[model samples]
Target: MAERIQKELKEIEKNPPDFCSAGMVGGDIRRWQATIIGPPGTPFVGGIFKLSLTFPPKYPMKPPEVTFKTKIYHPNIDRNGNICFNILKDDWSPAYTISAVLVSLCSLLSSPNPEDPLEPQIAAVFLKNKVQYEEEARKWTAKFAMS
Candidate 1:
């Protein structure tokens, strides 16, 4: 598991995506902390979103679990930090890697999916109160994710 993670890490280092910065944290080979720079033109812009990645012993076969360490106001994210992403759940595949997951998450920050929502209230906010939603998201980012 560690070897596979290291191999994936090397690939990420060579050509990282533009959204987030990732690295091993707390000196744990199995744990990583990623800092996502909220996407431009989105409510999350200029925000620092922190996420923790924990690989399963059977990772790639079983998807890694990602939870936001930083509070975020999104329909797909729950108050308890669970995310409502299909690929991260029952749709996981062996071909998926840490980089792929991170990329997906970064995309989600920009274009949120309302069809599958973890926080139902956020769904309503997304449809009816976009400006308010952005305000709450920005507030949470400042309170929790700022350096």
Candidate 2:
């Protein structure tokens, strides 16, 4: 497991994903920290979001637990930073890599999935009034995600 994690780390360092970077939090290979620069042309653009990944002992067989350490205003992400993305849940496969996960997250920020949301109220707003939702999302990004 540690060997696999090290390989992934080296791969990331050699070719870091666009708008994202991740590394071990400390000496523990099982814990990692990642940063995602919100995708361009989105309400989250220019915002920086932080996330934590906790890998289980049997990683690859089981998906890592990912949570946002930085607040983000999105229907798929709740106030507590829990994510509602399917790939991170039941759909996860061992074939998926950390780079793929980060790329998917950037895509999510670019186009959110309001149909299956963690924050239902936000989803309602998103579904009913997209302009309002985008305005609020931009505001939250400015307040909480901008450094």
Best by TM-score: 2
Model 1: lDDT to the true structure: 0.85
What lDDT does the true structure give each of the candidates? 0.85, 0.93
* Candidate 1 local Cα displacement, residue 49, angstroms: 0.9
Give me the displacement of residue 10 in model 1, in angstroms: 1.5
* Candidate 1 clashes between residue pairs 3 or more apart in a chain or in different chains: none
> Model 2 over residues 15-129: C-alpha lDDT tens digits?
9999999999877899999999989999999999999999999888888899998999899999998999999999999998899999999999999999999999999999999
Ten contiguous residues minimizing lDDT sum, candidate 2? 1-10
Best by lDDT: 2
Each prediction's TM-score against the native?
Answer: 0.91, 0.98
Which regions of candidate 1 are displaced past 4 Å? none
lDDT string for model 1 (51-99, tens) is 8889889876788889988889899999877899989999998888777
